[model samples]
Target: MSVSINKITVLGSGVMGHGIAQVSAMAGYNVTLRDIEQSFLDKAMEKIRWSLNKLVEKQKLSQQDADKIFARITPVVDLKTALKGADLLIEAVPEDMNLKKKVYAEVDSFAEDKTLYASNTSTLPITDMAALTSRPERFIGLHFFNPPQLMPLVEVIPGAKSNAGMVDMAMDYCKKVGKQPVLCKKDVPGFIVNRVFIPLVHEAVYCMERDNASMTQIDSAVKFRMSFPMGIFELADYTGLDVIHKATVEMHMRDAKVIFPHPKIKQLFDEKNLGQKTGKGFYEYKGDKYERVNLTEQEAATYNPIKLLAVAANNAAWLITNGVCDRAELEKALKLGMGLKKELFATMQEFGPQNVVKTLQELAAKYGQFYQPDPYLVSYRA
Candidate 1:
């Protein structure tokens, strides 16, 4: 039961949409990128051209091949024309559910019945949107990280009512576009990465505000001790403190116990200092581009990375035990999505699950029930 997706219609021309279109065109799929305005479409094309040129410069693709790939993308503003003949519709519109529902309604009327639908939503449940569409079984979530062209990980999530074979086909589509796909068996808020990652960021802030740890020390602990490629604060700033705050709020709305909006991030966001983009966040930046903050090895010893990892371990336990994903997929999601060199479960085991449980108990005492150790992590304690 394979759905042949030779022609792709990507609805939106923002960062994620343009990147999806570029990747699809690169994969030899004829792509139609539709937006509300011609200007948006033009800008997407310009970005695609720049990205394609960079690949050509690096010898990843020949100039001729790049040109052909660029030629394969058709940008339009007409809903009927854009949806016409599309075998797969990847919605990359804004994160608002209302806007998404509106787009889905339009697509339902315009798109072919055989066309499969996938949303690029990072947090929203696929099942909710799928139910609204004419074809619930064909709808799934294909979540791509920021800068989808470069990022390798794509979460292939199936709704509760999504067809089993379509889920498999979606995984194949991700591979066809040169991405590593991980299945998120359940469609919970934040899915896998955000489910765990958001709480980690919140705890890092908690360490700073509540524990009186400096951003430098917390970041040092994360990078040097935890072996994550980016420090917690650095990653937040790179992603924008405002963005993090919004995601935290959204996740909290779904599950108030485990996630909440942090005041520190909200303050930074309110100040209009949106990390690298605005040149100030937890730490200051000089320009529009990202520059790594310098921290000495001695600073890493000032804060324990285990405090951060404890929060992650608890969430990982819940995710695994609830069957959201297996140990392997959760590990891969953290590795590929979050860019961690170390395996999380392996690291937790090495650190001693009892120690993790102890840390979680401490955090729960101080921070409320959010840090309460899951039974799964506690089981390993004995």
Candidate 2:
């Protein structure tokens, strides 16, 4: 069964919503971008125009095509007008669940019964959001990373009651929009990327704050040893420490057992010195470029990128044990969404799950339960 998503209604004209609308328009869909105010829509359109123009300048698309794509997007301030005739409605509002649920309620009232619903929530569970809508089965999760036009990966998550066909349709729609879709298999806090990535970065922050390692050592070790495109701190800075902190805080709310960033991270967030955006983070992003180099065989062997990986793998194990996703899907989400370059499971295999468990055990013993291996993992290792 396929849903005809020829017309798309995207709520919120913020960064993610505008980019999603642009991608939908570019994919030849009639896109209605609705925000509370016309000014927001205007600013979003200007940003989209600049983004589209970049594609034209690079010769990725003809100017005519760009114009046509821009022409397909209709910005509206009225909610009912935007929701009318929209076959698919994507709620891309703020990360707050109440705000998202309110939008879902409004859209649900206005949207047609056949209108498939999806949330662009990164961490919030789809099941909780789906409960607000009239059509739970039609509701799913279509999580797009920041800069939807540039990032290729979209997580296709099915809520507890989401229809199988809707999940498949969401996946197909993702491909139609020039995105590579990965099935989340189930809905959980942070889904896949945030589930693992958040804890990984939090550990990096803790590692630095506890004087376990310097920021430079942490960055160099991961970049040189793990073959990551961005070091944890550098990526946090690039992603905005505030954003990372918010994700951690929200997740920590869900699971208090999860280790959060150190007080220093909160201090930086409080200071509004949020990484690249504010021009300073772990490393000042002051027109400086990172030069990553590969380590020698012996250096690579000794370079233990173990701590963060242990946190990630523990989360992975938790998700797997809960039947949220199997090993294959979790690994795929981590590799593609996090840009690990190498296969995650294969890397875990090389490291030995037993060893990962041991590392987690040692870390937990030294610090606390956050480092403790997932119960499933500890058993698996045994």
Candidate 3:
């Protein structure tokens, strides 16, 4: 069956949904932004308006184009009303399985047979959620990054029972919406980005807890030394330590062998230090300004943070070499999803895989199992 997606139905009117709707509308597709209540729908539309106007101010878009995009989106409270003629339905609800299942059940009733159902879930398995829908074959994971309109990469995860054609259809729709799509062979906890990244961040936190480094030094080292936009600690604060902790815990529960659970994260969470969202994480935040109080110079230079980061890069490379996804796709996801610089890959390619393995092995002996190189790295040998 051929699916020509002209109209898109975006379920949930939160941050991701609103952003996805904006992108769909900008791409000239008729979009219906749906929520459970009229108030939520109204707020989402207002946010979309604000975002579009900001784009216009930045010269990325014109007022006329912004008006046209807004006109393309129709906010609705009723699920069936929004989904009436939708060729594709993208669900961007909260990351609760029961909530997602319920939403999928409701969508299953109203969505047309040809409509492709795509979940914007970050970590949840598409196969598990697709069981709630009548058309499991049409269900796939369209994992978009936060602020979807700006991010270019989307993970196109086809459930085990999904139709082969659905993958191609989803990829086509992704390209149509100006998104780069990558395929996941099977559902894995944290998909691609979060799996390796969460562990790396957690390990960084663990280093802090061990008194090996301070938050400021760690973040500064990463940003200046490694050329990352932010340090792991700073990123945790920016992304919310609670968020990373929750994701790590969930991923650990799903795959015990790979994910190492951090006790300090739970300790900090218990202490109510939930990062920048709460004004205090590894550092303190006063309104819009952030003050670095936890970082020390000795911790920053004495500890080899770059070596730890290499372990993460190796894990990502392992995922690619093991056929979980392609190397190009992994690189794209890191650059787009995790805000990693493109040159990070160039650095690795320049270092050569064998050299990277030797460096990682030395770090592993000093830092523990987290820094250990994957077997694939050892075997690659340039």
Q: Top TM-score: which candidate number?
A: 1
Predicted structure 3, TM vs. truth = 0.89
Residue 298 lDDT in candidate 3: 55
The lDDT of each candidate is: 0.88, 0.82, 0.79
- Candidate 2 wrong stretches, greater than 4 Å: 258-261, 287-303, 349-353, 375-382
Question: Which residue runs of candidate 1 sit more than 4 Å off their true CA positions?
Answer: none
Predicted candidate 3 versus true structure: per-residue lDDT over 206-299, tens digit per residue: 6666556666766766665555667787777777777777787778778775566678777778888988879988777888666544544454
Which pairs clash in the backbone of model 2?
A: none
lDDT of 1 by residue, 1-382 (tens): 7668899999999999999999999999999999999999999999999999999999999999999999999999999999999999999998888898899888899888778999998888799999989999888999999899999999999999998888888999999999999999998888999888887887888878777989899998888877788789899888877767777777888778767556777788789988888888888888666588987679998887787888888898889888999888999999999998898877787778888899889878876888888888988642
Task: List runs of model 3 lying over 4 Å from the truth.
Answer: 270-272, 289-302, 342-372
Best by lDDT: 1
Please state the error at residue 357 of candidate 2 in Å.
2.2
Candidate 2 per-residue lDDT over residues 138-215, each given as its tens digit: 889999998898888899899899988998899899999999888888777787888877778778877666656666
TM-score of each candidate structure, all chains considered together: 0.97, 0.91, 0.89
lDDT order of candidates, best first? Answer: 1, 2, 3
Clashing pairs in 3: 216-295
RMSD of each: 1.4, 2.9, 3.0
* Candidate 2 local lDDT, residue 280: 79
TM-score of 1: 0.97
